[model samples]
Target: MVYIAEENRYSDMPYRRCGNSGLKLPAISLGLWQNFGANKPLQDSRDMLLRAFDLGITHFDLANNYGPPAGSAEETFGSVYRSDLSPYRDELLISTKAGYYMFPGPYGEWGSRKYLLSSLDRSLNRMGLDYVDIFYHHRPDPDTPLEETMGALDQAVRSGKALYAGLSNYGPEDTLRAYDILKSLGTPMVIHQPSYSMINRWIENGLHDVLREQGVGSIAFCPLGRGQLTGKYIDKIEAESKSGNSSMKPEAIEPARIAAFRKLEDIAKRRGQSLAQLALAWTLREGGVTSALIGASRVSQIEENVKCLEQGPLSEEELREIDSVSAVIKDIPW
Candidate 1:
């Protein structure tokens, strides 16, 4: 059967502005970082993508190194886009990044102009896209000069390879520098992608403050702490979970952490939500975050996550208990 999106898709999901840019992403965005890759089941990938759209998730995030074989996820997305999502091109916020290791040799990785631009071309080719809505430098390359990398991103927007430019995994100072460079070039930086969850509060220290001050929107990945904050690990890991698949090592969820997870689960139940819902709702409570990026191998997971928005934001007392539980959990060392 051909895929026709839900007519009321736009009604249920809330959209927020990405920084000061005109682009607005859904409050819940889908990410293809794990099981949606080529090595994974293609049918599952297609189902999840279609389901995400039905639930009003317009933003789909990707990276050059996302798939197990590297670049496979884009290829999968390309196939699905050609077959189903072509009609809704203008309505989607498709984004891909070019940092991290992609191919072999010197030019395959980093923030250099050569690597960033060329990787983007490959990403576009693989996705069968004329232009991506957003192109991001996957990570900060310490060896490369900030000017060179930011220049490449600006050039991408100017040349129309990407409608907007973004930065990922960049610290507050580096983000400010990149933003200034993009602003000088007449293409201001729009968004930042960082790893954030109740279990990992790295952004609370300074990243959030910087993003708000600089007016850059934030999309937080690992919103469930790589499945730690979800019900998947509340008891024992399912045989098919990410932890079972090596994306998250078994040792990452220790016995004590599981205990903490159950305690949090009770709080989520009290709030009329699942553990995953509680985690996502808490992540969005941060003022700087524009969206919380969620990755799933199954359509059911996406459906369950989408239902979180219906329950509304966490209450003040609930927020305090969540913080206490998160604090009691040990730092994930795996």
Candidate 2:
């Protein structure tokens, strides 16, 4: 069946500026970090992407090493793009990242001019696009010179291969350095992607303050704490849960995580909203966050998550109770 995008897709979700850049992204963006890989059925992944668009999610995040086989997710997205989404390209904010291990050898992964430039070319080929709206360095590369990395990203924008450049998983000091480097090169940093949820508060140490001061937009990933913040794993793991099976590694389901889930579940009960909704809304409550980058294994999950937008921000009392409970369990060793 040919997929037709929803006519009123742009009406429901509000868009926000990406830092001081001209681009505006939807409040909620879809991430293809999991389930969109080759291990999953193609039709199921396609449905999720289509459903996200119907709900007004304009941004789709991807990385070079996202697939189980490394690069298969972009291949799958390429197929989807050729078949269904080609006509709506103007309505989408497609992004891809490099810096993880995609190929083997010295320049396979990192922030070198050689690695970044070659990776962007391969990514554009895999996605069958002339250019991506945003290109990101998947992580900070301590081994590579920051100048070389910033130079490569600046070149990507200048050469018309990427419209904007961003950094992920970079701390305050490194981000400031990169921002200055890019700014000096006449291509200022636009966005930063970081892992943030009620359980993972590493960014709170100083990154959020830095982003606000520097005028960089932040998009938080894993806002549900890899499904733990959703309260789905409170009493016992469901037999059919994606991350709950016995085959799943123990490290993925730590004892402290279960304890945190129990505490979050209690807070949700008092608030009259699901733990998932609370987690999503709480991230947005912080001022610097431009959007929440979320992954949904099914169309139903996407439907449930979009409901958080309607529920809006938590009250001051609710925020206080959440913070108190969250602080006790925040140090859960992940």
Candidate 3:
């Protein structure tokens, strides 16, 4: 059957500009970090992509090392693109990153121009794309000169392999420095992807201030704290079921954290939201990131998560209660 996207897809969802650039992304974006890998069923991944598009999620984020064996997630995304999404390509915001360990040897990983550019070409080939909407440095490289790394990003944009450049997991100092370097190269940095959630409030300390000063938009990943903020482990930590979630180690799931999550659940109930929705809402509240990047195992999870947009902003009282709970279990490394 031919896949015709929902005509009214743009009716309900809101879009925010990426930093000062004209690129506007959906308030909620889909991330292919986990379930889109080769280990998952192709049909299942296709269903989630189609469902998310139907719900007005325009952005799909990926990275070189996302899949179990590395680079397989882009292959999975490419398969779906060639089949169902090719016709609607103009409406999609596709992004992919490189950094971290990809292949062996010196040029395999990190921020070197050789690795970043080569990895990007491989990524484009895997995704079957001429150019990505945004290409990001997955992480900073301490050994590589900042100019060389940022120059690689500028080169990617100049070579027309990526429309805009972005940074992920960079600190405030590095972000500003990279922004300046990209600016000097005539490619202004547009967005930053960071791990932000009720549990991980590290961005609030200084990164937010830097981004605001530079007019760089932000997309927050792990807004659910890798399923902790979802209220699934409020009663008991199921080690077998949650082992895949990186933040759910036995040592991290202390009883005090469980109590804090239960308290958050209570707040969610009062606000007429599920624990997941409340957590996402909190991540997008005042002074929060421009977009919340979410991962899903099922189409229903995407359906439920987008409802966070329908809910009102967190009230002053709700914010205070959330703050008090967050103060206890701050920065759980999600």
Candidate 4:
């Protein structure tokens, strides 16, 4: 089947400057962290990718360990890339990461120069791309020297395997170290992917200041707090609800979390928007966030999230009220 993109798609989203970089990214970017794996139907995944493109989401984030059977998500994305999005390659900003378990033994994961370089080659081969727009370390490896990790990232860009380098799940101190190493290597880090939300305030502890100082952009993953901040579980976890499954882990649905979700739901009611919309808008309240990396299990969820950008930024009073409520119940097993 032939697919044509919407002409006015770009007008729907407001792009934010990525720190001091020359690039502008959509306020909300789609991530294949969940539901885009081989476990799901191929057509459904393809439709989601095409629909996101039509809505002006040009950046798609993936990782080697995203799928249920590791690497399946990239393979699925590769299929769609070749069959549908290949013609629009220049218009997309594709990114993938390594530094997680994929194969067995020492060479399978982490920040070793051999592992990173080999993983990039495997990722590129799977995606059928000569080079990705951005490559990232999935997470920090305390066992590996920071210099060695940064060196591999530097080489990835130098060898033309990736255009830009980024770090994910690294704290402020580690991020600063990475920035300095990448700077000395003459390939300054461009982006940092971290878990942030109305409930998850770890970044606020210090990471934001460091990123701002270093001019490194940030894209927050799980901005909705893994569907908790969405207020979907206000009453109870429905038997058929996706959140009830083992994949979500029952421990994540603690009593404290439920109470906090209910309070957020009340705020959403006052704002005249769904709890999910409120949660997404809250993430964009802080200006430095270049994008909210979201995962959706259904097309309806994506459609709901897209409406958030239309509501614009939150008011100061609204933010204050949110802060007040957050202070009362901040720690929610995110």
Provide the RMSD of all predictions against the true structure, rounded to 1 decimal: 3.4, 3.4, 3.1, 3.2
**Residue 273 in model 1: lDDT:** 91
| Best candidate according to lDDT | 3
Across residues 14-48, which tens digit of lDDT does each residue of candidate 4 receive?
88888888777788899998798889998999989
Comparing 2 and 3 on TM-score, the stronger one:
3
In candidate 1, what residue range of length 10 has the lowest lDDT sum?
235-244
Reference-based lDDT, residue 290, model 2: 93
Q: Poorest 10 consecutive residues of model 2 by lDDT?
A: 235-244
- Whole-model lDDT per candidate: 0.88, 0.85, 0.90, 0.85
Ordering by TM-score: 3, 1, 4, 2
Segments of candidate 3 deviating more than 4 angstroms: 238-254, 330-334
Q: TM-score for candidate 4, please give it.
A: 0.92
Q: Number of clashing residue pairs in every model?
A: 0, 0, 0, 0
After superposition, the stretches of candidate 1 with alpha carbons farther than 4 Å from their true spots are 237-256, 286-288
Q: The CA-based lDDT of model 1 is what?
A: 0.88
lDDT of 3 by residue, 1-334 (tens): 8888999999998999878999998989999998888899999999999999999999999999888668888999999999999999999999999999999999999999999999999999999999999999999999999999999999999999999999999999999999998999899999999999988888888999999999999999999988877756564453533556645565566667666777888999998899999999998887888999999999999999999989889999999999998778744443
| TM-score attained by model 2 | 0.92
Per-residue lDDT of model 2, residues 230-271, tens digit only: 655554443323344555446445565455566677776676
For residue 128, model 4's alpha carbon misses the true position, in angstroms, by 0.9
Quote the positional error of residue 217 for candidate 2 in Å: 0.4
